[model samples]
Target: MIEDPQGTVLALFAAFCRVGGCFMLLPGFSSARLPMQIRLFLAVAISMAILPLLWDTIYPRAADPVASYVRLIVFETLTGAVIGLIARYFVLGLQFAGTVLTMMIGFNAPPSPDVIEDTAENQLTNLISFAALMVLFLLDFHHVILRALVESYTTMPLGAGFNPQGALITLADTLKQTFDIMLRLASPFIVYGLLFNIAVGLVNKLAPQIPIYFISLPFLICGGLFLVYFGISSMLEIFAAAFIPVFEGR
Candidate 1:
């Protein structure tokens, strides 16, 4: 039989605070399309499963007074959020790259509902982001994240209050690295857009009556589509490969 139900419950709640906080911002799990209840249940389930492993570390801490417990809850939630955001920033970087790619390729199609967020996004950006996320799922990216979360106790033990300065620095570094990677991934399209538009501008200058801009639109769109078709495999490959290392803080 259970010797201390109250301690167990408190421990579970502490675990949930961190695990749930992480899931609240996790990429695929945190999608606006997912029902909040489902997310909550999943977080609870994962917490229950992992609690035994963290019992010694968490259960002792759970015995604190109510005020201290509340402070611990806040600190645990912040730690989880920081870890989750590290992964999330990379996905955002991919989305940003997709947006840049869409504009560079000259596809100005009307915005449509995003698969993850409530906001509207360009069709091509949506497609790329969805595809990339799907690929990461197929590769078991969430498993990697969960493993990291388990290991996080060593790095961020319970009772160590939240470190806003350290968290901000970590977030800032992740963003910088992610942005650099996104730019590199989108550079080819940038060059293509620049050179293609310059050539079109020269043609327009030479034949003012030709309506070259209108004439070039179809070609630009077609060329961009072709580039995407040929380059998408390589692009997603690089993205998926980079995800784990960046997420694990390697």
Candidate 2:
């Protein structure tokens, strides 16, 4: 009994283009540990659930000529990818901070496969990134992302022409903000490493025969671990709190 079934199918496909594009790059959901089929199914399910709310805006656009539909598919995919990368960048900042932390603390564990990405990463970096991502999941970050996606229709309606310049600017701004936060989180360890190395250098100079550098390595590592033990909880707390604000451009 459905009239204009083709239009409905096209509209559903358009919705899938946006939602699936987002999931393709979303942090936790897009992790390498997740199978591609599962991610695809999840994206399809989410698109279906939200299609009703977006029908009026999307269906009319879908009813346009085939060429128009193709253009919409491209534009919507790019839009969703941009939105997903905004959140992904913030989560990546935690990994950046972890790498900096590991270097500053002198913990050079061998690289291993990362749970999130296919690339190999330092163990500490992997641990921190995993923990922070888990915390965000516990906080229901996906719900925030979905709400933002729904609201995005107002700001970036269907069939709007793509603005590469605007997307680039947004990406640049997000990088700057995420990097600033990472630096702040890692600053203490940076300072500690600098001062500790300087002191170790002086000790080595004063007693050239003594292996002061080697002797101090353990102490440096221990001190850094202690600092992380106390600061990690707070660090992840701040990171989790920033996700929604950063992604929403607030």
Candidate 3:
């Protein structure tokens, strides 16, 4: 007997909801402050467009109509979210570094437009985050993510049992790797803060009346800005290298 079209569509819609929920929280695609409805539409559109192509290979023909559909939605959403989040992890590294650099350079806590729900990041963090995002896109990191999704189908197929521990491990590794990259990204600024402050301290100690510490802020800030501008290319290159493996495979 032919499967009910209404049931199939409903099943697809359910799958879309789960996938879109993951996208709603994932980075890059959900980075904008667009209305929830618009984001929902985009997510569903992506899912629907891909469904026809991958339906046979991935989405099971609706059978039980209850448990099977539920499992399909859950697994599909988890996979999409995992892929999206892997990319987000890399982006967070840059953001973390920027936050530190900004604080060190006395540029912390500057006003910034809200880009996500519940809060806004510092302007410096936002800038670095945006730049890193561009670099990731330039590297076709999204393609890599899509590839990973394709690979995930083999490791964790739709309607299969969820792998909670594996997902946890992946997420944990992403967070750990992000922190490592952020430290590397912020190294120059950290060094600048250290040596620059040390030099100012020495001068202040020597001449007590010179107020060298106060006088050096502008020089330090300008020098830091220049260094960052010159170093960003290299920084992003390193980031790309670090990001490739996470999206590529196990």
Q: Find the candidate with the highest lDDT and give its number.
A: 1
Model 3, 1-250: lDDT tens digits are: 5366775676567557446755766666786566778878877787676666666644454434456666666666776677677777777667778878987776655567745434677876777777777787787876776555545656766667677789888888888877877798899899988898898899889889997856888888888889888988888888888888655643
What root-mean-square deviation over C-alphas does model 1 reach?
1.2
Clash totals in order: 0, 0, 0
Worst 10 residues of 1 by lDDT: 61-70
Cα error, candidate 3, residue 211 (Å): 2.8
After superposition, candidate 2 runs with Cα above 4 Å error: none
Superposition-based RMSD of candidate 3 using all C-alpha atoms, in angstroms = 2.8
**Candidates in descending lDDT order:** 1, 2, 3
- Residues 1-250, candidate 2: write the lDDT tens digits: 7698988899899989889888989998998889989999999999999999988988888778745777888999999998899989998888989999999999988899987889999998988999999999899999998998888887888888688999999999999999988898999999999999999999889899998868998999999999999999989998888787788882
Better of 1 and 3 by TM-score: 1
List the lowest-lDDT window of 10 residues for candidate 3.
57-66
RMSD of each: 1.2, 1.2, 2.8
